[model samples]
Target: MTNKLSAGLAALFSLGTGPALAAQPVDWQMGFQPAATEIMTQIRGFESYTLWFIVPITLLVLVLLIYVMVKFRAGANPNPSKTSHNSLIEVIWTLGPVVILLALAVPSFNLLTAQYSPPEADFTVKATGYQWYWGYEYQTDEELSFDSLLLQDGERADAGKEDLATYPRLLTVDNEFVVPVGKTVRVLVTAADVLHSFAMPAFGIKIDAVPGRLNETWFNAEAEGLYYGQCSELCGKDHAYMPIAIRVVAQDKFDAWLAAAADDVEAANRNLIAAIDADAKSVDVAANVKN
Candidate 1:
């Protein structure tokens, strides 16, 4: 009887933390941002662990429900146990949940520490929110800034004409935040004007960007994909227009993009210098002609 009781308790404990309580992402929508990183992976892991407990608990409850229905029917065991004052039963029931909770607390604490612990980041990016657009800044590189706006319906149709298509419409942006896959990206979030929240559901990261204040978060995507998000906080009338898009590519692709951005800056500078030289030449010719 003791062995049977032990087996039952073990089964009950396992049932308490089982599959039904596993944590899953919202859904399998075509995600663009990135894949499970250290933080998100740990979160998902804990969720699965939590589900393990929930599954056995649910099964135990279900079994008890069915057992009560059949075993306590009027035609079956008509008389129920009237001894409700058993001190041992009371103590056992009271301590059972406490023990279960203690068991859960171990993994729960480990996961929390993993999620919150600061990692040895590889790069830092500042994500600033404007009225209806987002600005990205690379901390290590100067003049690495650009605005990301939402593509119009016509633009979306044009993008579809390309070979590889991104997320449909729920979260697409004209300019995407580009990063190298498998790199630790430390994000420093701030708002240019009003309050906005930088949220990417797949990454399990959401931080508020407030004016004059900076909030920080980090994620390292394992896979290369376009992930989308929006300014969750209602800042103004155009809050809905704000969308966040991220493109995680290979390291070589990231290097090429950086070079492209550098070339654009250089070209703009060259154009400005040429225009200044032309103005000076014109002034010199006019002065010589007058003399």
Candidate 2:
């Protein structure tokens, strides 16, 4: 037990120093982005659960097809048995699909229900999708509003986002949706013009934004980090340019930024980034010392 615990700590230290801890799409990544919310974790679990039945059923069908082709070929058997109505095979086929459906239905329905039925939200934020950018409004007594545009290459230095590895191109933005970590945030999404979708893979959220309708979703992020996402819907010519960035910070830092963001959103964002960067460096140094 002592050896196992030590090995686990060592593995965690290695992971802590890696870039995978940050929530973003890694290059050559095939699977879903690393889950940062409970909802996303459950979604990934359900995906794995469904794959078990899918793989075996696919392999079984393929094997049966090959057997039928080889065994009943013209060269093998000129007079193939004309037994198309086998009661046993028919009953097996009918019952097999029914059983599989039942097995899948229970868990699938449960997950769907849980997705829509969120707990009491801590606070609310309204996101309005425009032609090529997103605008966020904090639904509080002292409401704050701002538009987040894609960060151009030339503006990276001014915004203090020059590190491509940390602030990826096409995914970073001028301002991010800021929220306190470990708090449930309900998002009301809608479109100002054409249809759009607000999707964040880390949160397992993909809700449509209609012009005349309001759709809502909720997420509670357990980790503190900058999570990146892109507009999944094809709204217009510049649909690909619309990216979403959410910065989850500690409560104290979030409070400070929120207080200052009303006056100047850009300056507040830069200060928040610096604070987060300082926290990250401190963590790295502490981990190295322990090692």
Candidate 3:
């Protein structure tokens, strides 16, 4: 029974921290993914602020509705009050919404400004959306370029990553967009064919990929891990299959990966997977020690 209880607690803990473990949507996930960047943190804060207003307002309206239904029933009040309008109530309702709007507007505008006004980028990457895939070009120094395609189930099995933990269904890709952690990355987003949206939920980035027009967005991921997104816009029949995977690593690891990828992408991916596995094992061992 003790062992069973411990296992149950562990499962619950894992469920609670699932979003943090992977920057992808999980079953029964209602809120945003664990924030990986400063913009996402601000986004979450604004959401919380809106929720504070929404919850109380909704509850108050509900209570008022219940009170009116109970107190103003036909049997309770035979003579209905002919009062059409209360000036004080009207004034309060009008001014109350205005105040709420103003409160919301301040933060909303600030968040928009922060998101649009990116810091001087440490590096720039150009993302071009295709009909069924994404192409990434490192525009800074090395001028490395590659196309990322969604990895099929069979391909995942061939890569020996059939487990959902490693290669999530419909989310994993052949080539992940790699970047260094804690550095501002400006992404110039465009499209070669139909429209697509370059979105990363954890990074709070979602910009349109319009053909012949480059839309810019930026993110500075603070943690090193694998984050997943998808083409948010409906481009074609295979829009669902166009997955976006980003791997944030340390500067040295990124440098090595970039160099290797420029030479041979397959070898570089294998090396990255090995390094990720090693890092995961070390973390697990440290957790076990603490336990």
Model 2 per-residue lDDT tens digits across residues 118-214: 9999899999999999999999766799999999999999999898887898998999999998999999999999999999999999999989899
Candidate 3 collision pairs: none
What tens digits encode model 1's per-residue C-alpha lDDT throughout 1-291? 665666555544432222111112245644332235667766766677778889998999999999989998888977776765989979988998899899899988887776567688888999999997899888766458777787776675444312123344545665678777789899999998889999876676889999999888888877655566778999899888888876665676566666666557333323432333354455545444544
Off by over 4 Å in 1: 1-34, 62-85, 157-165, 233-241, 262-291
Q: After TM-score superposition, what is the CA distance of residue 283 in candidate 1 from its true location, in Å?
A: 57
What are the lDDT figures for the candidates, one per model?
0.68, 0.88, 0.87
TM-score of the candidate numbered 1?
0.66
TM-score ranking of the models? 2, 3, 1
* Cα lDDT, model 2, residue 154: 98
Q: Cα lDDT of model 1 overall? A: 0.68
* Model 2 stretches with alpha carbons more than 4 Å out: 1-20, 288-291
Evaluation by TM-score, superior candidate among 1 and 3: 3
Tell me which of candidates 1 and 3 scores higher on lDDT: 3
List the lowest-lDDT window of 10 residues for candidate 2: 13-22
Give candidate 3 regions above 4 Å deviation. Answer: 1-21, 157-160, 282-291
